[model samples]
Target: MAGLKIFGSDPENQPKPRQRFADDVVGRFRAGHTIDDRPASLDEWRITTGDPDVAARVYELFGGEEPQEGAAKGEDNIEVFTAADSVAIIIESAKSLRQRMVLWGRSGKPIYVSDGEFILDENGHPTEERDPDADLTFQERKEKKDIGAVPDIDLFFRLADDPDLGIFLFKTGSWGLAYELARDDVQGALEQAEGPVKAVLALEPVSFKAKSGPRKGQTVSYTKSSLTLKGAA
Candidate 1:
């Protein structure tokens, strides 16, 4: 008797592995790839995912656009800022807590910064002494009032014309003693504002020891600071 031949046993008939939409996009982003000197676009995204429909959908989801040919790169296209330079930003939206507010900065970039913590040391200096490794719960932190708290500010910024390249974290004391003083001044201006405001932020690159997570011992650059408010919205 002839050996039985199995139907649908051919390797060529096997279905190809399904591609993930998010993973393809995220991988490119992590590799620091760009389209037209900005973040990658749908066309470029398609090269990796090989799914035109999904790539288009992802592009639309991010509100990204293809860079025009020969289009001049605007000053606002910058990814980095210096202390001497000021960024005029609009506050599109904000989520505020006692100590911090995650803001949608100019161009929709997310800005994570402290309002100023409530906890202070014996010398009356704000400190984050709580060990993240410690087996402490949120309720315990609340009970101890160890929750990070910062001063309230009324300041906001005008929306940027373009989308943000990425997120930024502006710590109160990330720059230095002088930058901290400037940040305080900006906070004071916000406290006095009666309505939505536009502010020019003075940013500087600073490095500090990581206080939490696996990166605890590593040093990283701090890229945000509040310089001054330009005007009201």
Candidate 2:
């Protein structure tokens, strides 16, 4: 019931298309009831979905429109996003992002991402297939003709006060270690969140300062706040 559970959309056309990559990030958004950045205020977690095939589901959730610039009226072009409009729409809307487990993928043409639905049990119940190491398992997704595993899901956002930074990303550190403890906390927190929640955040570099090898002295990103919501007290 915890550790980064993302719900995908299926009812109809919705939220993608601009071609975003892991390194494209500039900043992040946090879940806060107000425009504050301190840690105690931040609550909800902005992490990626646990589904490996989350890539395909992403396109399904937020589909872009086909170009209609040169076409005749009512040409029915696939309503696409020339930019990161869906993220903008969600932020501007009064809807709770919790409605669908959001996992950001790309901004351009939707490509092939593996179907990560859970394999069923003998009695047709979902098996224990969804559990993948939060810091190790990678999605079987890729951009068109692009090599390597899919980049982790990230969000497009900018500080409400620092508009100078433009739109950046609150990248769900899919393979990073520092977020291990936080991911589960996030999974549990999101489950309890409700209503139209929104907020601004200040990213802080945090360290657990592991006393041993490998990760000793390593630094990972940490968002310092969460938005306002019922029961998030």
Candidate 3:
């Protein structure tokens, strides 16, 4: 498989939050093996599946404390992520692509997103359906909330601890499962594992510069580097 060039704003202009996330993602992409970013055509097919609800699964698998303020009283808190540690991911898509798949009616193409085991309603009632894109009523958001959607520090370690779904970078193209990079090695403090497992990632689109002035097209690509697994720290 060939690699795709990742384009982004100037590093200097990127906020700390974005830069930190991007560096972490790029570092993982470069870990354990020499990887290259080559130019290729954009993949028409794509899949995304990291729901906030499933965030708790990460904390449960790893070790971390949840936020104190929002957590229900007397409930044991799990450490995951906080407003102080939130990260953002930005992906590139042509208007055509976005409209065709992500938007409604244009083609009604299916977009893959996360669907956890449960859902919540106002007053903390459990619900049967888990609709990722269902419009949330004001009451639903005000009272009904999913504890699992929130992130915690524990999620990092869980990825490292769990064998089934460890820290990884998963990419899919037209057919399916294009590439997956799971980092099991923790190198000193730079990549230390605080718990039994750890996983973090930043995902985005690959970008490139056009060669010619007019009408010349650019390309995107995806490639698998190497997979490494070090023991718990």
TM-score of each: 0.28, 0.27, 0.19
In terms of TM-score, which candidate is stronger, 1 or 2? Answer: 1
lDDT of 1 at 5: 56
Evaluated against the true structure, the overall lDDT of model 2 is 0.32
Tens digit of per-residue lDDT, candidate 2, span 147-213: 3333233434433333333344443323332233234443345444543123433233344656667
lDDT of 1 by residue, 1-233 (tens): 99555547889976686654321221111112355668531121111222344334334433344322222243212121111234455443332102332233556543333323233344444567433323544334334433322222332222233223222223231223333444465445555665546655554455789998889989975444434546765
For all candidates, the clash counts are 13, 25, 32
Q: For residues 101-189, write the lDDT of model 3, one tens digit per residue.
A: 11123364323222223344443344775545346442343233332121111112122333333232322222111112212212322
Q: Model 2, stretches more than 4 Å misplaced?
A: 1-151, 156-169, 174-194, 207-210, 214-233
Candidate 1 C-alpha error for residue 42, in Å: 28
Instruction: Return the top candidate by lDDT.
Output: 1
Query: Which has the higher TM-score value, candidate number 2 or candidate number 3?
Result: 2
Ranking by lDDT: 1, 2, 3
What CA RMSD would you report for each candidate?
18.0, 18.6, 22.0
